[model samples]
Target: MNELPSIEQIASCVSGYDPNALPVAQAQEFIARFVTPVAAVESIALRATLGRVLAADVVSPIDVPAHDNSAMDGFALRGADLAAEGDTRLRVVGTGLAGQQFDGAAPARGECVRIMTGAVMPPGLDTVVPQEFTRSDGDVVVIPAGAVRTGDNRRLAGEDLARGEAALTAGRLIRPADLGLAASLGRAELPVRRRLRVAFFSTGDELRSIGEPLDAGCVYDSNRYTIHGMLARLGVDAIDMGVVRDDPAALEAAFRAAADCADAVITSGGVSVGEADYTKQTMAKLGEVAFWRIAMRPGRPMAIGRIHAAGPGSKAAVLFGLPGNPVAVMVTFYAFVRDALLRMAGAAPEPLPMLSARSAEAIRKKPGRTEYQRGRVVRGADGDWHVSLTGAQGSGILRSMSQANGLVVLRHEQGSVAAGERVDVMPFDGLV
Candidate 1:
């Protein structure tokens, strides 16, 4: 097995890489090297399928509506029977309603049938006159106007979707509209990818769980809840392993349990090189560390590795150790674990959406590192988009995140951007 790389060594290895590259490019490289998707299928009811990836293509088994019908409440008539101006009266032979059909042939010359919306058109009827244009008088109907066009106000069967055609392809995530479509096709269930199981924990003797008595130099454990909420948003089945004190034996036991039961394990606050940080040591004992540091702000101390099987018939579990700071934990997850979880769920790669906006204020940045500044974007009166930062860029302030609707991306080589300069803005709602 290869020895674990030190933080300095990992930085040296990737030092020459471009820092101006988009987040997607950086994430793809990491995903290709460290992520392996599991292949499994499960049957889920249509009501519960939203956000789940489809394991197979969905083909429509039946035609929508299954028959030609009327799109409006009108009088069904043969096109030839339409009279010129000054024509006043026509005979009404029958009526058509939804779920009930007029079995008789279409109306003959100067004859018509009353039809309601969604009612199947009677055989031989090629046109329909709206009820507003006609008057009824005891077995007599009046169509007092110019000629009406043929095939008007009628809906054709299978016009929306053809039978046996692919309605949705594999790897598409199901949405509310998609579920409605499946219901229209009469599907009671769907085949979807099984949810990925994730296990996560927070490490530090200075942290206390919520509802527990506070002690000196102790803060309530927050990373665990933050990770749990983030995973919930991604639709993963996340298990909270609670907080682990800075003890090697306790950490080892937690890792063993997570490796035995979960596809992946995540921890925060113990991967850095502080004197009390035992997580890196334990990780070196258990498996090879793939990478330990990245050339980015707020999330520099991060680790990715795999835990070796403890015994026969056991499989390795991917492990991620993130920085202890709350903001850093979130940024690292969005920059790394989000894509890994998506891949593990059998989802196809999707690039985050980006928009161009003018900066509303001046931005200062160095030339060697990329920065993600929280920003608020709004459409100006001229219909152009503009973005401005949400005040301070401190890595420890979680409040800044709540005020931001998107991220203002600063390139590696760019020094300063003045107001009204075009910049890339990525909306946070869709990405994480």
Candidate 2:
């Protein structure tokens, strides 16, 4: 990793720049401006490039079709031979099948050749009338007027893609359709950015991993599981470091080890004030980190900055210190970490779209903070999207998060919402 500017310097460039009361949108913007994407590239098999980011432009080496061909099973003829306002009859001289050339003499005026889909167009013929649209008898076929036009059902050379043309742009996240496009261009491998390695763990003395004894005052750690699922969906290399205790030395050791091996380190808990400040203290000592109280419901306190392990040849890793609650962990990950990771992977970052829907009931909210309420949206008898809350909007309720299909986003600078009012929702169908 290259040397980056100090956190304070980066904060100074943001408008309003207040860590105590940062708006959600401003916080997002600041992270986007500060994060730097990886630049290394590697060539891999085309089958393995799905969900990977392209490092270079993919150019077509040959025309997609390579030659002018027929796009439908029909009779190929000249456009001028058709009558002005009535059906015109023509004689079928020969047949043109796919991948086979027409060995017979070229069709002349008033004569046509039977052509199948994907078959090369014979010489001197530029149009085709679909066989289903015509009446055929023996070796003659009648093309109804207005049913066939010049250039109809004819595919010209390079119609889909031309030779030496850019098929896919650099920095684009490769998808299933992109794979097919590259295969059509005769590419066996693609140049893609290296996959991002992310290390994550939860922080709490009362948190225990599954299969461990459930001692008094201890609950099983669910944040790690949720975080792992989210990272997998994002197509990153996730390193689960398990749960770190609240002791200073243990927390410091975990942070240093995670920073040493991963491009980014994520820790949930110990970012808030009071008893759980050991992680924050340790992080501040190791790197130039910023602790923020973003103006958002369920997720407020967050630590965003860079960390460097203490040793020679040590590289700096970006850190995200999220809140302690279960639902808060998922919310903060969606609201913040998801985009940062995408940007770090050298891919184009796109925000999830928010759709408008009508609320089922009145909801309480403040004017200065944003809220994400778990909601179930279904089409009513009137054919409109109507949403109802899953249940309580507590920060720790993971069941509500599981039951809902989308999140109803209440924006900042907005107050209470009434029943039947239109609102924006972020769907979780493909994301989860």
Candidate 3:
């Protein structure tokens, strides 16, 4: 195994380091460099490969389709049979169905064969005319002179995938289409990376898990549940450690336990400056964690580093300390932790595409920080995509996030946006 470089080395490589005003791209690059993917592989059934990372490249064993076939229910005939400046007619010698062959010698110059969709082409036939384009009269079919060109509507052998061609590359997350492709290649099972194990918890004295009676000064803990759902969507093996109170010993123990078992640890509170909590202090004692005031609204405070467990045979886990606010936790997770976890799970880097849409209303934005506002995108009467804020943009307002289908991303150094201006949006659903 290659040893990972320390954060100090990574930071030194950065041209300039600003602890209080880090750019989103810089932070992402540092984190990507610091993370190491898990090195484990397993063979699983094709049906169970969905969302799993492919460990090895898959090469096709045979040609797809295996033979020249008609792509439509058409008449398979010689291109030379097409007459110039007039209609052409030929005798329909025989019929060919899928999985059945035309029983005879090659068709003559004035002869054509009736072929169905996916049926292998008859010998010496190189073109197909759709059945609809031809008129049949007592085993004879007539076709217009300019109907089809040579090799039209005919799928040649090995057209989709040739024998010995690489079908799927390594380090790819198997999706629905990938599963079908593997099945078509006659593969019963695929080699995939083992699922990444991640343990997460919420840290706050006033935080309570579900089912606990509401106290006078405390609120229910929703960060843990939200984090759970987010991790589940990433297909990671999650270990929810419940809520860790604001006690030094309790928080340290939780960190140690999490590092001992999981490949990574995520906590949703206690990293902000001027916050009266022991989560940060306990984290420092247990690991090498750095608290940062990122130049990003809604999720400015974050902690990233690695924590080590005590004694021999103990393992170390990467730490991600996100802000306490409900929406901030989600924003930080999607922007940072999501890709980090995907990398640690042995998946290749796949950047999410930012689509542009018109803004429905003016937005108040400053110049020095990145902001992610919950937005609902819709098609306007002008037949163009327009986006408007869901509701209140507070980091604690979880309802806005629930109602939003995407986020209007305002990058650093960008000023206020006017109505009808094009802005970048990151969608919540669809291809990641």
Candidate 4:
């Protein structure tokens, strides 16, 4: 059997690589390295499909609105009738409302039709006189002073979108407004990427499941729940493999089960090179470890590997072993697994949205490590963006994450930033 490579040896295989690259670049490369797109199909109601990644482009089967309609509550008339507006009185031929059609022809010369908001205009009527600009007297509407041209106030059929046009492209993430657009195109259902199946677990003998009796030196298994909730926000189907004790056999069993059922497996803790860490030994026995020890602060001991086939019929599964610290685990997952899952689900790869802000205080960092500092950003009355640290930058301080709205990213080679220096800030809310 081949020997497993050390963390440094595995990293050295990728030549000219900087361990101190920014999180953005490292994240991109990490996703490209592991995740493979899956072929999946699902039938989903329009309302239930929000936030789902579209599997195919949405084509409009029919024109939006499907016909000419009134854009406002007004009287439909010929523009020629208002050539020289002087109380142009026209007979009210008929009325129109939303979802109700006017079957009659347009009014004759010097005549008009009374229409309401979203009503289809009667045939031959080319304009509308807003009710505010006209008065009704029994069977007639008197246009007092306002003037409108032909096509004014008339919403043309297919104006918003044409029939057979690509209304939305594949890989687009659906939003609430996108659902409305799909409804306008008469789509009751949509084709979306099947939710990714992720199996995650927390490894350590000192961790106990929530709701279970706690023993001395044992903490509740919070990382698994946290990872599950975060995966929920990304619309993934997550499977909790529960807690795995520090025994190599138990860890191997859990990893094999996850590999059999899930597209990827994520675990917190046990990848570090320690006597108590059985994850490394089990991985050596079952598969291959790709790389570990990302040079970023708070998450330097992260590991990415692949579980080889357990038997002749077994398949491979990607694995991410994160640091034991709560904040480190969260940060590593977002920086690594989030994008990988998105790519596997066929979502468009978009860089996390970033904004430039001036730092309210100086930030110090070592020259060899990339840093993500928790921060709060505010837009002042003058429209300038300013950011300040939330609190301590410890990897175990999950409280700082709750208080932070954004992450102040510092580059590897960049030194301490002055108070007024421009920095890149990434909002935490939109990130998966």
User: Candidate 4: where is the Cα deviation over 4 Å?
Assistant: 1-15, 18-24, 84-91, 136-150, 211-218, 273-276, 366-369, 379-384, 430-432
Candidate 1 vs candidate 2, TM-score winner: 2
What does candidate 1's lDDT look like per residue over 317-403, in tens digits?
788888898878888887778878888788876876888999999888776555678889999999999998898878767778778
Instruction: State the C-alpha lDDT per candidate.
Output: 0.79, 0.91, 0.90, 0.80
lDDT of 3 by residue, 1-432 (tens): 566787788888866767677887778887898899999899999999999999999999999979999999989999888887789999998899999988878999989999999999999999999989989789889898788988899999999999999999998999999999999999999999999999999999899889999898999999989999999999999999999999888888899999999999999999999999998888887767777888898899999988888733357899999999999999999889999999999998688878799999999999988999999888888888899999899999999999999999999989999999999999888622
Best lDDT among the predictions, by candidate number: 2
User: Which residue pairs in candidate 1 have backbone atoms (N, alpha carbon, C) closer than 3 angstroms, thus clashing?
Assistant: none
Tens digits of lDDT, candidate 2, 1-432: 455767777888899989999999989988988788887899999999999999999988898789889999999999889889999899999999999988899888999999999999999999999999999878899888898888889999998889988889988999999999998887899999999999999999899999999999999999999999999998999999999998889988998899988999999998886654488888898887899999999899999988887743478799999999998998989999999999999988887988789999999999999999999999899989999999998999999999999999999998999999998999999887
How many backbone collisions does model 2 have? 0
Q: Which pairs of residues have clashing backbones in candidate 2?
A: none
Query: Model 1 Cα displacement at 387 (Å)?
Result: 3.0
Better of 2 and 3 by lDDT: 2
- Residue pairs clashing, model 4: none
Candidate 1 lDDT (Cα, 0 to 1) = 0.79
Superposed Cα deviation of residue 212, candidate 2 (Å): 1.3
Off by over 4 Å in 2: 311-313
Query: Which 10 residues in a row give candidate 3 its minimum summed lDDT?
Result: 306-315
Model 3 error, position 264 (Å): 1.0
TM, every model: 0.81, 0.96, 0.97, 0.85
